[model samples]
Target: MNTSLPPVEAAPTGPDAPPPGAAPTAPAKVPMAELFITFLIIGATSFGGGVVAYLRNALVLQKGWLDEERFLSALEISQALPGLNATNMAIIVGDRLRGVVGSVVAFLGITLPGATLVMVLGVLYASNAKNPYVNAALIGVGAAAVGMLTAVTFQIGRKQFGKWIDVAIILVTVTLINYLHVSLIWVLLTVGPVAVFIYRPSQLEPPSVPPKQETVP
Candidate 1:
């Protein structure tokens, strides 16, 4: 009878290790000018309910300024803050990247352009209450905003599904939030403990001590 060789175990890899001279990965650094420009553009384009969705796209998907987890955390924090969600998010994200100066720059980037645009629109609406062009433009922009929001949703869903448990949580949270209109606190209260119970990683035990040498030794 012939004996087959046992399967070999793979070697552990170090962070600096790469396969066959592959290109090295670079560390991420914040680009302040780009950050300001991005938020400014998002502010100008984001109308009505499009702020959150556009911010997600501009910051995470398009610019890669923040990863998914960081983006989600910023969103949560912004929501808890007083003021508009987009503006609050700008401050948080800016501060995260460039400290206080970054926060101020980000705020001005989002607010100044938006303020000017809104004021102009307000004047126009007041002067020309029944203008067809205004109505048409608003309707078209609103539809585009919906498309952007949908894109943001899809992006977030993709990130969440990177983990199987995340997918389950997402599905459940979406169901509760959409159908039941429950607050996030309630959702967290229901799912947080259960998730902890189910997915908690096992703590490693200390190596066992051998029995004390016998007195006969």
Candidate 2:
């Protein structure tokens, strides 16, 4: 008899449930202490740039506080903002779940651990800048970060890959950043609006021609 529970799925819904991407009408709130502990754990354990991966696992897969669609929505909002993605996500999801107080609690929880670790690591690196073991560890961490980011990118964009327009957008964005060396500001200012227009409602919907006149029976 195994004592462990099964892993939770990303979205748990039955036939009658709302469509997959719909945001839940009301999010179930957790205790403030619990919320803080959750983000704190994520902040401490998530290495490199993979905080978003940890966030998705904790918030959607484990906590069930947010559905997969809602998690993605929050992630997009965080990316558009001016701060670190992990902190921005903390604020957005915290507000949704626990209001102003929750946001404060979450922000502190997520930042405090990283802040402390950075200070300590900075001191250690200053003293042992050329230590082979330390250098090797950093390189390993970088590799893991790249792998995490790649997996998450593919998971998030799997649907878009099939759409030529979306694929074009991805390619263009990468080309601009990698080959053309376009400033990120310019890329966002130009590509963002074009992408929006391409997917706008009017472009997606067929023109509303008047219904063909029906012959009276």
Candidate 3:
């Protein structure tokens, strides 16, 4: 008399099982065309040199393409290297999303609009160099550019402004460049090393003191 029920199978474990309480990661593959279009929009619309802010807003906040930490990490790499921040960011983010094709498309998208606009402006400027109206417009544009630059500088440096060391470095650098008329090369060679040393890991360590000796009876 076989009365025993069939044994129930346990759920599969190991590689087949998703880890308990772990979140699913976002997809890695973004479309190349999407990358190009995103940068194209940024290039055409971003003005006043606030492209970094625009980038953060679009990629991190609007699109969810990158988290804040990841965006900042990429920005740091871009800033450390020699190139326009916008293009550098385009290449890094594009490569991260889709590889070589992504990089090429992003670079073209970010640059093409600006390049075309610049060429048109150059032609117009050359033709109307002595026109009073054009001269007035250029002056107005320059003033606006200065204001934008100052605003962007302070916005980017807000965190650093709270720190004394950063403020000191900034002041010294400004004095050297503006007041002393130091050559850019010499300033970089000297101030760069000093600033690096000031913030080095070794300088962050707390000094070790010998333990107090026991008193004799």
Highest TM-score among the candidates is held by which one? 3
Each prediction's Cα lDDT score? 0.77, 0.85, 0.83
Taking all chains together, each candidate's TM-score versus the true structure is 0.47, 0.64, 0.75
Model 3 Cα lDDT, one tens digit per residue, 1-217 = 5654222212233345444324326443455667788999999989766789989988887767787888999999999877889999999988887788888998899888999999999999999999999999999999988888899889889998999999999999999999999998999999999988897888876657787788896
Ranking by lDDT: 2, 3, 1
lDDT of 2 by residue, 1-217 (tens): 6644332221254344554335556543466887889999998898757789899999998888898898999999998778989999999999988899889989998999989989999999999999999999999989988888899788879999989999999999999999999999999999999999998997787778998888997
**Higher-scoring candidate on lDDT, 2 or 3:** 2
lDDT score for residue 122 of model 3:
99
- For residue 4, give model 1's deviation from the true position in Å: 71
Q: What stretches of model 1 exceed 4 Å from their correct place?
A: 1-27, 123-217
lDDT at 71 for candidate 1? 90
Candidate 2 at residue 6, lDDT?
Answer: 31
- Candidate 2 Cα deviation (angstroms), residue 101: 3.3
Clashing pairs in 2: none
Clashes of 1: 0
Write down the worst ten-residue block by lDDT for model 2: 5-14
lDDT: worst 10-residue window of model 3: 5-14
